[model samples]
Every structure is written in structure tokens, then in C-alpha cells.
Target: MSQMGPPRPGASMPAEKAKDFKGTFRRLVSYLKPRRKKLAAVFIVAILSTVFAIVGPKIMGMAITELFEGAYGQLQGVPGGGIDFGVIGQILAVLAGLYVFSSLFSYIQQYMMSTVAQDTVYDMRQDVNKKLEKLPLEYFDGRPNGETLSRMTNDIDTIGSTLQQSLTQFITSIVTLVGILVMMLTISPLLTLIAVVSLPLSLFVIGPILKRSQKYFSSQQKNLGRLNGHVEEMYTGHQVVKAFGHEAKSNEQFDAVNAELYDAGRKAQFISGIIMPMMSLIGNLSYVLISIVGGVLVIQRAISIGDIQAFITYSKQFTQPITQTANIANIIQSTVAAAERVFELLDEQEEVEAVTTSVLARAKGAVAFEDVDFGYGDNLLIEGLNIDVEPGQTVAIVGPTGAGKTTLINLLMRFYELKGGRITIDALDSREMSRHELRHNFGMVLQDTWLFNGTIRDNISYGKTGASEEEIVAAAQAAHADHFIRTLPDGYDTVLNQEVSNISQGQKQLVTIARAILADPPMMILDEATSSVDTRTEILIQQAMNRLMAGRTSFVIAHRLSTIKHADLILVMDQGQVIEQGTHEQLLDKDGFYADLYRSQFSAKVAI
Candidate 1:
């Protein structure tokens, strides 16, 4: 459905390092600004949850100490010495209540954060969609459609998932780290120091891995977009590949891109994947050191048995959040990479805003181009070109490829702004009107037909919203599509598949012609509209177009010279300039470029 262009130079190069990671991250965080109240509530709930969970170990250690002391006293034959069931039961109940409240608060925070995360991404997607709409057609023309689609689908999905899952976890990890550290210090500063010793070591091991993996993560995303683009392009044009026997070549290209994607993905995962194990190794070493030191302190009676037990638990708890934070840091790195891509799209130059200074209630269909200069890039394709078409006249543009026929239509429709001069409809400068208003007065039927997945009737009615069923049928009849449609099982109600392959090529062309007829605009553009049909169908379509063009200014771009022999005027164009302009017969009589082209076509037919 989309035209594929050559990949831009260096498209396959490894993605560049993120120029401003902090800036991108700040922009990403700004999305949460709108939900500040919800975020505040989530933070409060997270703090409460961490606080409750942090105190559980200390309270449980009290129960353990009571049992240990009682048993020891009994072994020493002390009077009235045994486990205190009543006190231990009360302590156990309090511990259970703390855990229950902690879990409840955790659930509350998760639910609130989930809503905040979803809403943030929803706004991001909306903004991206609007940004795309405002972007110039040149943007789409310069890149593969799948690359853009990837930003909308794959890249945004990555952001959404990270916000939903990782964001809350990041918050909880921070709170837990702080709360557990405080609790450990209360028990013993010595043990707290031992536990925190792993923090810097974890950072040391993680920093280089993150730094090295950042580029790979960026490369992985870039190559993934390229891979998607290749697949979409190949899939849509699979029939062309088969027709031209380029299956092997297509496979080679796909395999090469797939291999690149695999390489980038593997390296990214491998590099970032090292963080967790390293953190765990350092954490386990810290745990071993804390245990040995804790036993010596217990022997010296420098710390109570309950305090030592709680301190060890806090030591384990301390390292866990550090490990989690490290892992999240890697995830955030990847997410920021995705955000950078999306931001790149959002930052693309948009079409100039429409400055509407004039409005046409109904155009008279008199179109003119004066001193026009335009091009896709810096080099002009049409320079100082001019043309005039009167109301109710059909102007035929005949040219070789790259002769600027389509460029003329693009300028007329205001798809691209002119570099010099002006084009006017009924003497109204096109730039003075909004694009929607300018395009509303013209109907176009191109050689490559477009029909979305819908019933045939719906496709025809797309030209004019709210078109009556009878009007749709009338338009179809005028285009000579009614008969073939009725022959189908569902007739007008027959649903077109995604590719619209259920209908013949001729039928598809007829359907597009019907759509144009239904539009009934003041002007029409037919670009080789009958090129896909058989001779009989072409003749029928030409007749329908003749009726459709009555009393409307029409521009027809044709390659077959015979098709435009009777036009009111013929402009023979070459190298972005009109070489000859006259009635078809008058040009035939001139024995010039037009005459030579006509005779060559005639001779070829006769030879065949």
C-alpha cells in the first residue's frame, strides 16, 4: 500500500549514542507532571508499605529471643524459667498484622501507579499521532512506512510497558533501600556499614556494563525498525517479487537485516544481562561478611541476640533493593533509548501552518500556474513553468517519466509548497486557502487504486460522506462497474479483503472511478486511470470519465498518445518544461516532438 524508497545512506550504521540522556529522561518524566496528585498518593502509599514491611524482622526477632532465653534458663535449672506463651502469641499476632497492612498498601500503590502509567503513555501516543498528521508528506516519502509504524507501535509499546511495570518497581526499590538502611542502623551501625559496602561495588560493576551496553541497546532498536521496514516492504510487494523472480534476492536482503538485528539484540542483552549476577555476587559476599562479624558480636555481648538476628535480615534486605535498582537502571537505559527515537519523530519539522486569508465558496474551475518553481529538494524540477486551463476544458499532459507531470498535480493540490511563483484556482492564490479547502474542490483517480478493507458500497461512498445508497449505485453504473458487481455473490455488499484482491484489477479501477464520480468536484485529475483495465473496460471507463468531466476542469496525465487525441489542449512536456502546446491534431500537423511521439506509437502498433 506504501511506496518504498531507497534506504537513506548510513541507515545500517550502529545507532549513535544518545546525545543528551538526561535531557531525554527529563522530557520523559514530564509526562508524569499532569498526574502529580496520583503520583504523590502512590509515593505516600509506597513509603507506608516499606515502613511496615521493614519493622517486621525486628518484631519477629523479639519472639525468637524470648524462646532462646527461656530454653537457656530451663537448661540452667533456673526457677520459673520456660517459654512465655502469652507474650510470644501477642508478638506473633502483631507481626501478622504488620505484614497484612504492608501487603494491602503495596496493592494500593500498584493500582494507583498503574493508572498513572497508562494515562501517561496514552497522552504520549496521542501526541505522536497528531505530530505525524502535521508532518509533511516528504517525511513519509523519505523513509519506509514500517519505520514510522515502529515508532507508533513497537517503540511506544516499550515505553508503555516500562512505565507500567518498571516505574512502580523503581519507586518501591528506592523506598525499601532507604527504609531498610535506617532500620539496620537502628540495630547496629557496624552491620549497616557492612550491608552498604555492596552498594558502591554494585555501582562499580554496573557502570561500565551500562556504558558499554547503551550503544548496543540503541543499535538494537534501530536495526529492529529497519528489520520491520524490510519485512513490511517485502510482504506488501511479494507478488512483484514473485513476478520478477527475485525471491532469492529478497531472501538475501531479509536474512542480512535479520542477522544484524540478531547481532545487536544479542550483544545488548548479553552486556546488560551481566548486571544482575554481578550484583548478586557482591551481595552474597556482603552477606557472608555480615554473618561472621555478627557471630563475633554476639559472643562479645556487644549486641543483643534479637538485634543481631534483625540486623542480618536487614543486611539481606539492603542488598536486594540495590540489586533491583541496578537492574532497573539497565531497563531505564533501554527505555530512554526508545524515548529518544519517539522524541526524534515528535521533533521533526511539521508542515507550515495553514494561514487562511481567502475562502472559495465554489470555484469556477479556471486554474493557472505562473512562474512556478518547485522540487523535492534544492534542485528545481519545474522551473518558471506556466500553464492556463479554462473552465470546462480537458487538458492532457503527455510526458516521459520524470517530466514533472505528477509534480504539477502535487503543487496544484498544495501537497508541497512552491519554491517560487503561485498557482491559483479561479484566480485565487492557492496559498491563501487552507489545504482542506483547496483539496475539497478536486477529485482524483490514480493509476494505483486504493480500496481499504470494507464493502464495495462503503468504498464508493468514501468519496462523499453520507452519500445515499441510490447515489452510490448511480456512480457505479456510470463507471460500468454495476454489472460486474451484481455478478458477485454479495454485489455491492461484498466485502473487499485487506489487499482488495477479491476483485479483478479492472473492477478495482472501476470502483475508484465510481468514487471520483460520486465526489463530483469542480475539477478532476485522472492519472493513467484506465491503465490497469482491458481494452473493453478501458473504453467503458473512458466513456464514463467523459461524462464525469463534463463542465469540470480536468487534467489527464496519459502515456498512450491515442487516449488524449481529442483533448481541448495537449501540453507536450520534457525536462520539466512544456516543449509544445496545441490541439492534438494541430501538434500532429506540426511534425515536431509531439508529432514524432504520436507517429512512433502508431508505427509500433502497426508493426505488431
Candidate 2:
């Protein structure tokens, strides 16, 4: 489906797609409620069309009955008639007219149903994406991007397709089926009873198969997610895989996944497919028995020819809805599976909602963390950590790797819920205020610059919606990205595909920095912001950072000690604690852990 070759060629589909469907179906129904008007319209059209279909057959049977009665002299001929031309013409005309009306409503029915289905999908995708945006950074840890994307795209699409077909068609078939049954019961209850007797048998036979199919269908969705995740991992790390000559291993893994998916698909298909044919054969046999009884009754003069004709038509109609429903077992399972995945995401509790507050005064740029603690789960990354970046000051956080520098920054930005302590802008606690209100006042440039496939202008102006040309350019200039951007052929309007291999890594970092600068927040956070740049670019970024930090609270984290040498205050961290806090000169005087780290770094540089 992803053009990634088949699913991982050897991995098996899981047995449980999820725990249960009750919660999922309930949530899914909520989305449908908003568009109920359209659903009602579809139902109306389907009912009308079914009525017309029944009328067409009834008219034919009536015409035959009229002729038979006239020939047998049971009824006097109309004005000039053996089945009068005018009467026949009227019936035929009404039947034709009803059919035309039916076709018109059918068209309307399909169009409205499709619109409802697709629009619901569109709304669902938007909602999921919005939820993801609000979710904390921890939500994505170890979660496969491929699996998430599949749920948003393929899984959502499956629900849309099911809505388009099953919802409207099933309604139509059911109404038609019921109308036929009523007509048959009116004409001959005995025959109608016989025809539908086999119907219950269908449900009984399909019940267990449906259960198993449901189980397999759920597993199929999950396996598909895993397969996508594996393929995405392989694709993203293609260079490493090739460099390590692991193609054979990759192929073997993929083959195993693919084989499992193939087996699952085949099995689910067979299980669901068997029910419909079995149902149809049983229904047909019932119809044959009913027909034989009806014919015998007609021959014995116990039932009229017209009545028998209508009964046969009713018999076909009686079992048709059941047949159609049975046939859709596979599709229904697919829908349920997809719905389960989508609902799972929808059900994940969103982090604290950011309330909207009145616009505040421009930031005076004071940030403080008083006794903060945080971690992904049971493990604590930072405990009782306290720090401050005064207005117009640059403060740096330095530590051994995984000393929670990034985790700290994430907490300050409200990317994760702080387990303990308070982070404040100026003097107000971040939790007491709205996230939007607080975050709108700071700019953060991440270490990994996420670039969208758009013109360079789009990426830079991403957060600053409705930004003007001069504003974007000015920000770029301040970040030192203007020079490189001008070097590009299209300047501001150059289209950048994901294949931005031609650009240097430092250039992209500068571009991201420019985006943050353009945002013009009262404060800024730069975490290992210059980790990958050359000495020259690092200096340039540092200079731009210095300018950006002017009159603003700034927090910087860098592994290389040389870059953060000018920080107003240095916070030395070790194992989730602030072991030391001072200016660079003050720390140098202590001659402790920071000094030792500095020495080790220089020694390593010399060895290299």
C-alpha cells in the first residue's frame, strides 16, 4: 500500500488489534452526529427509491391479473377493453415516472452520502493532527512515525470508504427488504414465512465466523501499522543500512513481515467470504421451496396468479437484505478494525488544555525554575532543579550527557508536565496561566530543524502567521540566514523539496534560527543549537544569538564548553541535581567537576 513492497515479509499479524470495540464505536458515532442532517437525507432518498422499486413490480403483477380476470369474464371489460389501453397506459406511465423519480433521488442519495463520508474523514484527520500538536513531546518517544501516519491516513480512509458504501446501501437494502416482506405477508403469509425461514440460519452460521474475522481484522490493522513502522525505519536509515551492508538482513525481515500479512489477509478474506455464498445458497433454496408451494396453490385455485407472482417477487426481496448484509461482513470487519485504531488515538487523554487569556505586556524576559522535577515515567531526569536567567542575560546549562538539559528545556516550554516544582515567566507560574498565552512570548530553536516541503519563506514564517515580506527578511538577517538564502537561485521564493541535500547542515540551522528570531519572543531557548556547525558558522550563530539575547532572557545548552563561555551564569548539573552554579570565572576558581569536564574535553580535542 505504501509502495514499500509488501508488508514486512515474515512478521505475523497480531491476535488482538485492541482490547475492545465498544469504546471505539461510541466515539466514532460522536463524529457522525454533527452530520446527521446529511445522513437523514440519504435515508429519505433510499426509502423513496425502494418504494419505487416495489411499485414497478406490483404494476406488472396487477397488469397480468387484470388481463386474466377480463379473459375469464370474472370482471366486465372496461369501455372498449380487454385490459383497456388507457388503464394499461396509465399504469405503465406511473411506473416509468416513479422509476425516473427513483433515479433522481438515487443520484442525490449517493452524492450526499459521499460528501458526508469524506467530510467526516477530513474533520477526523484535522482533529487527530490538532490533538498531536497539543500532545507533549513525550507522546512521540519510541512511537513509530510510520504507524502514526498510517492511522491518520489509511485508517481514516477506510472509515470514509465504509461510510460511503455500507451506510447508505445497507439502509436502502433494508428498507426494500422490509417493504417486500410486508407485501408478501399481505399476499400470502405462509409463503413469506417459508421464504424467510432460512434467513435466521444465515445469522447463526455467520455469527462465529464474524467473531473470528473481527479478531483477525483487528490484527491486520495492527500488523499493517508495524510493517509501516519497520519500512519507515528502513527508509529513513537507508544510508546506514547500505553502509553497513545490511540489505540481506533487511530483506529477510521484510519478507517475514510480508508473508505474515499475506497469510492474515488470505485467511480473513476466506472466513468472511464463505458466509455470503452460503447465505445466498440457503436463501435460494428457501425461495425454490416457496415457489413450488405457491405454484401448487395457484393451480388448485387456492391462490390467484397475481398473488403468486407478487409472492415470488417478495420472496426474492425478503432474503436480499440479509444476503447483502452477509456479503459485507469482510468490509464491516475492515471498518471496525480501522475505527478501532482511529478511536484509540482519539481516546488518548490530551495534556492540560491551554486556556486563553488577555494579551499581556511585552516580555521583560525573566525566567525562573524553582524546585522542578520531571521524567518520562518512573525514572526522574531532573529533581529539585532550580535556575534563573535574568533579563538581558545568557545562562547556559552544561552537564554530562543525559543530565536532563533537553528535558529541562522541554519542561520550560511546557512540552511535558513537570512532576514537581514551578517554572515561571517573570514571577507567574506557567501552570496558573494559559500555555498559548505563555508560549507566545518566547522563541525556541530546536536542535533538530524540522523543515516542511515548501518554499523557504513558508518555513520561516510558519509560526508568525500573516507575516509581511520585510518582517521575515529582517528576522532572517538577524539570524545570519539572509546571506545563504540570497545565495539560492530563487532567493525568498525558492521551492525546497525534502531532498535538501545540496544545503549544508549549518545553513539549515541558521534558517531555523531565523524562524525563531522572526517570531520576536520576549525570551528564547537554544539547546545544543550549534552542535553540528563549523567553527565559523558556530561563531556566526553565537553572534546572532548574542544579538537575539539582547534585552531578552535566553537559555543556552551546548555540549562544547567553548561556545557557552560567555554565559552570564553557568549551572553545572550531574545526575539530575545542580552540583554547581556560578559565572565561568567563579566555576574555574572552584576547580571541581566543571573544571574536570573542561580538561577532559580539551584533552580529547588534542588527541583527535
**Highest lDDT against the true fold, candidate:** 1
Q: For model 1, what is the error of residue 319's alpha carbon versus the real structure, in angstroms, after optimal superposition?
A: 1.4
Worst 10 residues of 2 by lDDT: 1-10
Model 2: how large is the Cα RMSD against the reference? 5.1
**Residue 599 lDDT, candidate 1, scale 0-100:** 89
Give me the displacement of residue 217 in model 1, in angstroms.
Answer: 1.1
TM-score of predicted structure 2: 0.87
TM-scores, one per candidate = 0.95, 0.87
CA lDDT for candidate 1? 0.88
lDDT by residue (1-608, candidate 1, tens digit) is 11212245333555566778899999999999999999999989989998899999999999989988898889998999988989999999999999999999999998998898889889999999999988987788778888899888899889988888888888899999988888888888998888887898888878888888888888888888888887888899998999999999888887888898899899999987787788878888999999999999999989878888988888888878887887788788889989999999999999886678999877889999999988666778778988999998999998777777877787888878899999999999999988888889999989899999999999999999999999999999998889999999999999999999999988898999899999989999989888778999899889988988889999999989899988999998887888899999899889999999998989999999
lDDT of all the models against the reference? Answer: 0.88, 0.80
Give the per-residue lDDT of model 2 (tens digit) for 1-608: 00101123223434466576777777777889999888888898899988888777777777667767666663564554455656767877887898998898888899999999989999999989988886665556547688788889889988999888888878887888788877777788788778767868878988888888877777777777778877988998999999999999998888887777777788888898888788878878998898899989988998888778877877777777887776665677788789888877877777776563434456687788998987666777678888877887888889887676776777777877888889877787788777777788878876777777888899899859999999999989998989889999999788777866657888888888888888888888887878877999988988888888787788888788887788888888876678998888889889999989888999999999
Instruction: State how far residue 499 of model 1 sits from its true place (Å).
Output: 1.6
User: Which residue segments of model 1 deviate by more than 4 Å?
Assistant: 1-14
